[model samples]
Target: MQSHARGHLVYAASGVLAVHTERGTSIVPANRVAWTPAGFTHYHRAHGDTDMRIVFLAPSIARLIPEHPAVFLASGLAREVLLALTGPRNHDPAAPDYSRSARSRLLRVLVDELREAHEQPLHLPEPRDDRLQAIARMLHERPADNATLAELGKTIGASTRTLSRLFRNELGMTFYEWRTQLRIYHALVLLADGHDTTQTAYACGWANPSSFIAAFTNIVGTTPGRYRTSRRTTARASQLPTVLKSPD
Candidate 1:
């Protein structure tokens, strides 16, 4: 958990990463990256054995990015540049004279590529009001809890109408909409942890697999099974050691 004066791009070379900020939480997998603007208080948590890579940008370059935190797809060129910039040798503090000119050029290219990358629908916005916060916490702690807003309001001592208004005004979404987003965010973590679709659906408060699949696909751009499979594939590939053949 940390924030810095410098804005940075965060990438996960092998596993899933989640970036939590005031605006929302963004999930980064192998195919995507997250950008945290300068002076923003944010924290990251790795979902698995993650190979996280970060590139700090100067204020001038950082200003070109979104002021709020965002998640972007890692383009082919961006991925290559990221690997080059974060590679072991590039971080050698004593090797100042090593390809200084080329490295600077690569950094510019990386920023340009990221600027054009499309934002993913991975952000889970937070609600600021105390009433909304309490509701969010309850849903977060017990994702499987299927209590309706009216039912929840009884426990929290707020009218269903008041809670609904707060959700829209603070979070810019209805109670149901916000709850679905929360469930999807939790679903991502459960799926990454290797839960099957049916189990994840039930755990995330979906009444059935079909409904869950529809919601997950609409938000995540893929089915739960596909998302899990992709994560597993990336993890296994990252673990494989490089092999070199003897000279013939």
Candidate 2:
């Protein structure tokens, strides 16, 4: 996974991803588009053979987003705008010199669409459960850490048996699986932040890069390098103004 930061925007895109947020985890399909706001650390991996698109925007583009990771509705128009903005054709012109002003115009339009796009809750809040809240916070803050059923039971003032039952009834997944997903989610963020997969794997608590690669490919449908390369190539191809340098 490769991610680069440009201005206030850190765009990370992949195909068929499963996203885990503080509230919960869900799968993102082609019909659905996903993104996280600036400075909001989140993770996603491709769920199947798919192509993902991400576009980050500076806070100056919109005042509505204050501080939080959010998912926005990629309306049909929004999708079209993103495609056009990222297309290779945007960089090409028949003139002797590419116009910087034209490239800026396209980027402006792309940013406008992103800022105006509708927001959605990829993960909803849980019922009034402070313990769950604590667990969620801990996971987001440090996804590598694991709590056994007995440990969590003691920490949350419940028994292992009870905690097991609650996890099934409330969270809908076993503790280990949930933790794995959380770590994987955060790993994606690290990867998108320009952290190497090997470092991300170690930092996110994977046994090794191979293990991380296995999980990443299985869930994100592509390797981290492929994902980052695509995003960079798309961003550069879409926004770079055509320039001609005459022989000196």
Candidate 3:
């Protein structure tokens, strides 16, 4: 809990949330945008640990914005443009300034897309009961296990019927849906770690690569290879090893 209020824009690049406040709680997920108005005290509980970008706009820059704490769904173009604008070169003066001349024009167009973006709800609900927490933890611990709802219910000491209702009422999804989201979210971490999709698929409990790819593509808006390539391509500051030349 915070004593003083503050205004900020928080983007969850990956992961999910269970946010609580007087404005009410929300479930948030990847590629989603949230702008908290000045003095809104809220505590965010993450569904899974995630990487995020936060731009705290002062009153001067923020006064122009109409909504005080608006949440929006980020479009594909906006997401790509943001990634590019915030790429490695932007942080390093020694790196070729991609902001020069013609490059500056391209950047302008990308920023415009972000300005017109709209919010979409990505939050996943959760149960207040501790028993459900234990079940959720088990699911998180073995994302690839593909535990059937019946199996999970048995382990958690709740009947499958009761668990199904609990999942919908408290978690806002059927057991299977929640599991799928968990798998896709975890896959992004593996991909970011430079693991190939095939290996990631198996490691994450996917029976095969195709299934994992489908799940990842559906939620992440891109394939694992494409995402990895984007990472490496934008990794402009990578140090190279020097070797002495022996022969021409």
Question: Which candidate number has the best lDDT?
Answer: 1
Of candidates 2 and 1, the better by lDDT: 1
Off by over 4 Å in 1: 92-98, 236-248
lDDT tens string, model 1, 1-248?
Answer: 66787888888766678999988788786667899888788898877666677878778677777888888988878876776666645545664533867866887888888788778877778888888888889999999899999999998899999998998887788898888888887887777676799999999999999999999998777787887777666656444322211112
Best by TM-score: 1
- Where model 2 places Cα greater than 4 Å from the true spot, the runs are 1-32, 35-128, 240-248
Q: Looking at candidate 2, what is the lDDT of residue 125?
A: 33
lDDT of 3: 0.59
Residue pairs with backbone overlap in model 2? 1-224, 3-192, 14-52, 16-47, 45-220, 46-219, 46-220, 46-221
- Model 2 gets an lDDT of 0.54
Candidate 2's residue-wise lDDT over 44-143, tens digit each? 5554333555445445543445344445545555555555544445444553432566645655765565567655333333323576666767767877
TM-score of candidate 2 to 2 decimals: 0.51
* Each prediction's whole-model lDDT (CA): 0.79, 0.54, 0.59
Cα lDDT for residue 122, model 2?
A: 35
Which 10-residue window of candidate 1 scores lowest in summed lDDT?
239-248
Q: What's the distance in Å from true for residue 88, model 2?
A: 15
Candidates arranged by lDDT, highest first:
1, 3, 2
Q: Give the clash count for each candidate.
A: 0, 8, 8
In model 3, which regions exceed 4 Å deviation?
1-4, 11-52, 57-125, 235-248
Clashes of 2: 8
